[model samples]
Target: MILLEWILFLFLFLGLVFLMGKYMSSVYLGEDTFFTVIGKPLENLIYKTSGINPAEEMNWKQYGLNLVIFNLLGCLVVFLLQVIQGYLPLNPIHAANVHWDLALNTAISFMTNTNWQSYSGESTLTWLVQMLGLTVQNFLSAATGMAAMVAMLRGFTRKETDKIGNFWVDLTRGTVYILIPLSILFSVFLISQGVLQTFHPYQHFYTMENQSQVLPTGPVASQVAIKQLGSNGGGFFGVNSAHPFENPNGLTNIFEMAAILFLPLALVLSFGYMVGNIKQGLAFLISMLVILLLGTGIVWWAEMLGNPLLIKYGIAHGVSMEGVESRFGVLISSFWGLLTTATSNGSVNSMHDSLMPITTLVYMFNMGVGEVVFGGVGVGIIGMLYYALLVMFLAGLMIGRTPEFLGKKLGPREMYLSVIALLVPPILMLIFAAIALMIPSTVGCMNNSSAHGLSELLYAFLSGAGNNGSAFAGLNTNTLYYNFSLGITMFISRFVTILPALAIGGSLAEKKSIPESSATFPTTGILFIAMLIAVVIIMGSLTFFPVFTMGPLLDHLFMIHGKVY
Candidate 1:
């Protein structure tokens, strides 16, 4: 316990420490004001879009209204494409038009960065529709997430303001200046790795096996770009990152994993930069890392161990090389599962359904953590900060000392809102998962395997609601029940946490950045990050542990004993 606590401080808490140092550097390095860093780019965007200057500040209502309208238009546009895909060209699979409910749900899903796919990619979306609808939303949703985070940071840094930068301005800069350029380079590089980017239809080529060879292709590079850039984990093909054309090589694997995590990781820098308090960002990043690493290490190690049952049945151990994608080895696959759930990339290379029972639970628990470690695009770091403020406030209250973070006082209003933001996703996950487990109609998903199989169904709900998008490959997830379940999860995952985050950002922006005092929690130092880690673990374990235990723990033990249930 003590050792685990230290690990949290060193890696997770180090973020806080780094933030202080980084904040100092931001202070001394450029002498640039916040407006310059944020405002100038926004000004350029305003010119390009409306041919007008938004130099004057706007009210929260105006800012929020624009964001809502913009996203709704996006939703309508994306939904139309899917419903009208039969009319589009380059559809080799002759994909049919999507139904109304599914189309609306999908549109909203992509618009929100949830990307909870209910259909197979190759057979569902036409090449044009894929690019127009799903692919486009990937970028927009990611930009939205980044914008939200920036808004929250503005709140923490500002002394008094009704505005938290222009939402349109921040969204524009994050997408054009940052996400686009990086995604373009990444797409070209992925092409070098043999990932397809052409409009060519599914190709059939001869192989030595003399068997019919079916190959799927499309504008993969475009979708792949924002999937990572926006922290939106939706994949182009049905099998997602598992498809050879989508992730063709190991280096590409490394790059995609990095893309999936880069901004989420870079967000540490952004937070510290915005607040003029580096430690705060670092502390959030470090605490997130501590939780992420522990989750990753356990999943990796468990998967590497192979199932004890398989070993007893004379199955090979060390690495179950046969069950995973040959293009990327088990090591890479484990890394992807770790990275994807840790962020929001839902694409799967290896079959997670095929993984050992214990391993599957680890993956879901990662989702349960609520993506705080350099979390999906804008979401993760911001989410972590809310909780960080919560802990700081509680700690302050306990000692009868005023809670000060960076320069702002931690008060009841901020604390309540942050807690609400933090609680929504996890609560939704547990309630939905529990419902599915207990309800026979929902539990029909467990048609094949034992309690282990049942575990996969629960995992999908957890992943979807968490907006992580990966799945337990064991189930035949093509039914109406799953489609609807996944849709609900995606919606809740994105919007539930988003509203609270926005509110918090709005509140924080009104306050001014305060100077550190005796009562100020040294978040950047090891201690606070450790506290954050404890909070995450306790919350995660208590929240999901019992359900996970019934779903996987006993099932794993049973599978090992050959009881099979």
Candidate 2:
């Protein structure tokens, strides 16, 4: 039955990919789309009202400057909203102002499209704040990524042109045409699936054991839809999708999981459409799937084997069900765990802290590889392209030819930017995590000791730096140190790559297309796909293997000897 569900999901998702990919390409290409009739008027109104000229084009520097300024302003607004939300309307529970550090952290988190939540939603925020602050950021942040991506794509497709697309136009179109429509439909479907969407206060009740329970509810369906579709995984409730109200049953579970990857994967195909090379897109799609499926298989097999220590004690069941929602069982939970981490969507149906050591390694590796296995909406493909550039550079070195991608020459400038963009996240993740471990006070932040504890700490930084906001749930990250440090990490990791990509785009856009020659490396074949996957694995493994050895690998060895950490 689980296998059937998996196959069914693949069928539905692939069908959506081609359809949606073509539509998205049309939207970005400024061609006629189904939404254009309605979207055009609304888009024009936004441009007029905001004083934005839709016809204006921007060089890479102008585009990057505008992009950074816009996101920073958004970060400021969200931070102010959180800190002053108590004075704002719709505070039925009268939730107090958030702490400054957390507010800053969350502001940066959402602005970067890394929706890392240090606080439980129900208790920490009111409905007004949730909608105006977090929900709004969900749409904008994802659109920010999409805008950056489209700009980068334009850089490749056009030659001898200093202009990439206008940031405002791309941002507006992405939100209006792509995110808003899909989110509305997904929200309606979620509401039908019994996910909550109400402004009512928490319901106070007594249980059969005379225990008090508060049924926390809010406008969850709306947030869940965008969170999944936009790859913004900040949950309305504390436990994320694990909360029954956020994801109620198998049907909702499967759909929400599909939603997470839907746009990211489609955008890959969309890249092909934009470049006029369908094979190029398919090569990327296949490479991503190969990595994604391999990771999923590993997690499934390891979790199904159950915990070795529990099996030895004769206290285990059919599968490792610890911290798993009984409704989804091992197969779905394992798949969701891997899938969520595989992309930038951090929503989880199971507790990642309880995953096996090897499973932890895989999850960490997914992020450590920069989450380019169908990564966060627009940015994931950008990350993959960076790897593509790196691979091409290496291929050029071997074949004794100048490397080119989509007719744009990969020169020293492009290679330097790509290397920085690719390597910065892992480097920052390691340095900060190492610093945290050295501080004696930081030990108190962990819920476990030794290797498992190391995994928890490593996972937090990995999630933040990778811009993939999922946690091991074993780390207490609300403290002053974590809030500020992780927030800084999130900000740096996000723009370091984005700015470099933009600069590379600008550089490429200015250069004339180098005609394909006998020395040109073919990027649309099986060999290219194989090399792409190999580069991703080799880069990821080389950077993260030692850390894995110290963390999850050691944890697994310890677990086999009947030692639990």
Candidate 3:
């Protein structure tokens, strides 16, 4: 039954993503779409009202500048909203204003599309701030990523051009045309599945034991719809998708999981369409699928194996379902854990910290590779393509030929930028994880001792730096040290990685394509996919193998000897 469920999910997801890719390409190229009639008028209204000229294009510098300024404004607005949330309207629960440091952390977190929460949602934010601030950033942040990806894709498709499309236009079209309509439909569908969509006060109830319970409710369905769809995994409720109101049943669970992966997969197909080669996109998609499938399989098997210590203690469980919601069980929870981290959608239906050590290792590996295995919506596809360039450069050297990709020669300027982009996340994850481990204040935040604790710190840094919001959940990161440090890591990772890729795109756009000859390397084939996969894995493993040894790898070995952390 579990295998059938997995197969069904994969089949439906692939089919939907192919059609979605074609639709999104039509939207990008100014062709009519299903939402054309509705989307066009709203898009125009946004432009007219905001004083934006949709036809004007931008060079790479202008595009980057616009993106930075817009996000800065968004950061400022969100910070203000949080600091004054206590005084704001629609505070039925009357949550207090956030402290300055935490507010700043959150502002940057949401703005950068890394929704790492230092505070619990229900207790810290009012309905007003949740809607006006956090939820609003969810749309814009995701659109920003999509815009950047489209610009990068434009870099590949265009020849002898300085412009890489207008950032404002791409941002507006992505939000108004694609994100909004899908969110609305998803919100309605979630409501049908018993996910809450309301502004009513918390309901008080009593159990048979006369224990008091307060059931929190808000406009969850709306937030959840985009949170999953956009790969902006900021849950309205603090426990995230694990909460019943957020991810109610098996059907809703499946929908949210599917939603998490939908855009990332579609963007792959859209890449093929834009470049006029579906097979090229399929190769990229297949590589991602292979990695994701293997990662998921490992997690599922480990979790199902149960804990050795527990089995020795005569617990007698068939498969360990610890820290998982009973409704979803082990299979779905394992799937969600791998999918969420793989896509950099950090929302969780299960506690990652409670997974078997081997399962945690897979989780860490997925994010450690910069989440390029179907990564966060727009960023993942572009990041993988960037890696593809690097792999081609390496392959060319191995085969004793000059490297070229998509008809553009891999020159020093492009190669240097690509190498830097590839190095940023792992370097940041390592440097910061090392610093945290060395510092007393940061080390004291660990929820467990030794290997498990090291995993916690490493996971936090990797998750933040990768712009993947999932955590091990054991680390207490609300301290002044962690909040500030992780915030900086998230900020640097989001922009540093993106700007370089965009810069390369701009550079590539200016070069005229060299026509394919007998020497041209084929990127859309089994060989390319294998090389890409190997490069991604080897690059990740080589950089972080020691850290893995200190954490999940050690924890697994120790547990086998009945020395569990």
What lDDT does the true structure give each of the candidates?
Answer: 0.72, 0.90, 0.88
| Candidate 1, residue 144: how far the Cα is off, in Å | 0.5
Misplaced by over 4 Å in model 2 are 1-6, 208-210, 316-318
In the range 1-565, model 1's lDDT, one tens digit per residue, is 9568546644643454344334323332223444347644654766677754435444455656667777889989998988888888877888898887778767877887877776777777788778878877888888887777776666666668877667766666666556666788888888887888887667898889888887877888878877876778788877778777788787677677767776777777767776766566666766777777787778777777776656665776735665588878776787788778888766677777776667777777777777766678778876677777877887887888878766677678877877776677777766766766676766675645667766777777777777877777656555565666666767766766666667766776677676666656677888887888888777778878877887788777886666854
Lowest summed-lDDT stretch of 10 residues in model 1?
21-30
Q: For candidate 3, give the lDDT.
A: 0.88
- Model 1, stretches more than 4 Å misplaced? 1-47, 50-53, 476-478
Ranked candidates, highest lDDT first: 2, 3, 1
Worst 10 residues of 3 by lDDT: 312-321
User: Which stretches of model 3 miss by more than 4 angstroms?
Assistant: 1-9
Best by lDDT: 2
Assess every candidate by TM-score.
0.89, 0.98, 0.98
TM-score of 2: 0.98
**237-265 per-residue lDDT for model 2 (tens digits):** 87999999999998999899989989999
RMSDs, each prediction? 5.2, 1.3, 1.4
